[model samples]
Target: FEALHAAVAGLPVSGSRVLPGLVLRRDFAAYCPASGELAAVVVTESLHPALSAPGVEFVVGSEGQYQASLRWCTRRTEAVMKRLQSSNVKLLLSSVKQQEVVIYYAKLYGVSVVECLSSEEIALICEITGVSPCTPFGDNGEITETAVATFCQPLLLGSKRYVHVGFTSVCAFQPHCLILCGPVDGVNEQHAAALQGAFTMLQQLFKTVDQ
Candidate 1:
């Protein structure tokens, strides 16, 4: 709570409550989604531009966080179900939902949801791996891997072509995993090596328990 409060103070923006968009880092139990599943959800307009893709569909919602799209993602479990229901909808990468919310709704809807690393956690991963989050405030790490992968991977993979405004959250499984999002091609070898080293060190740290 103190960390979040401090991060918020650093931001020029002000709000009574911490918005999901403002979240840079968080920690919680991991949730598991069923294998080979596709999900969708309502995202904030702030996020829609960066997130908009071919397979994923979007509809305007009151708030960027919880809206109709999330509902659709939850209710429409199978691609087959979505197809049978609507010809226009297409599934891209699965939607990233909060772990706690996913667990509660998964049981209620009988649809499985996956646990994702928090935005700050992803930032730490990049730092540990030697890759910079590359934002003015270094707060980009506050986003989710799902968001990061969607926006950043294209830049890394050479599809998106231009940098978009606002932070796109992304995550990775490796301890020192570094995901760079930008029109810039190929992670420079130096950064890549650092990421490799960081990941190695992190792995060793975790291995302590196993030992």
Candidate 2:
């Protein structure tokens, strides 16, 4: 599915294999669609874009240390969210659900949160944005300084909702999306394999011709 999706996008953008578009396949999970600017793609270790601070460990009689850890995290998380907000980052995309404390601060800072993104989707976003996947910030191995998305929204297709966006920094051509849907998993898998193979062939052919 990814190979085909990228190939299709390559066609419109002068034919380089780096995908000029992004695709979101439905996983049959019930999720609401949303719209926001994907201005930055940050690779995070934790839900928040901040690093864990050095704090005292909690012992049987020392719950204060645990409380301090929570407080430290919340303060750092809020600071990070504020930076994102000031930078006009309206969307927060995470691979998993974050702690409510993270959510509350993001909301307070006026950033929309979208969780449950798969690794592929996140990688695709990074590629489209030309963001380095291994970008590091401070002592933490997280990236917080990449931006590219121009427009973003969620679209309802079939029985699922998919996020859609138009890129501002895409390849020379316009972005594209190829959504493949099937009633059953087997059917979709077969179709995805076939489609991917076909596009792979075309990609090889294009590369040969370009060379």
Candidate 3:
């Protein structure tokens, strides 16, 4: 990570704004899609397992399941939501249900939620916005001031328009780079091909150097 930081810093920039380091927080967790069970309970400085026991499982069609789910969700979400609600920066999730109960709570808290993003997209958004993506229901290390100057506007090429969004935070998995390109005209393949070629070349160069 330090070497990558040095390399990025060594790159020449045409403007006066120092290129922010592609530095991710040391506390970021590893990606584990199947680890949902591991996060069923969120322990924080203020919230801990000692405060409550796991709820008893009830049979289907009974209110037990709903009550348990809601209790778990609220306890888990509240831990992080309270911290984020007071923050001035925007929040982006890789994917979230518009009708999810969490969304309703998030709205109530005045949190701005951008959903349906992929992990890569979230990382890209972080790079452009300089906001770290925090783990849901987990500790948010330190909320830094938003990098207002780092915002990027949508790129329009002919008929296709591309938007960049990110999820950057102290708990992001790692720093990443992403470039999204699509045809403005539904039939235009040339632009997409060119962009893909450039991306591939860049990847190959990086891999070669790493080797």
Q: 53, model 3: CA deviation in Å? A: 14
RMSD over all Cα atoms, model 2: 7.2
Which tens-of-lDDT digit does each residue in 1-211 have in candidate 3?
Answer: 1211211122223211212323221111111122111111111122212224458544457688768766775676665556655554333233323335455555655444444444554444455445554444335444443433223223332333333222233444444432222323332244345556786899899999999
**Whole-structure CA lDDT of model 2:** 0.56
lDDT of 2 by residue, 1-211 (tens): 4522422211222222333355454231222233554564444444554333458543534678767766776777777667666666666656666677777876676666556667877765665666653332356534455556666555555545555555565445455765555555565566568867887899999999999
Error of 1 at 87 (Å): 10
**Pairs in steric clash, model 3:** 125-165, 125-166, 126-166, 131-168, 132-168, 132-169, 133-168, 133-169, 159-184, 160-184
- Each prediction's TM-score versus the true structure: 0.23, 0.69, 0.41
Among all candidates shown, the one with the greatest lDDT: 2
Candidate 1 local lDDT, 53-150, one digit each (tens): 67887556567555656655544333322331232211111224433443453344333222243455444434333444322112431222122221
Query: Which residue pairs collide in model 2, if any?
Result: none
Q: Which candidate is the best by TM-score?
A: 2
lDDT of candidate 2 at residue 40, scale 0 to 100: 48
Model 3, stretches more than 4 Å misplaced?
Answer: 1-69, 95-99, 127-132, 139-186, 198-211
Arrange candidates by TM-score, descending. 2, 3, 1
Residue 140, candidate 2: C-alpha displacement in angstroms? 11
Of 1 and 3, which scores higher on TM-score? 3
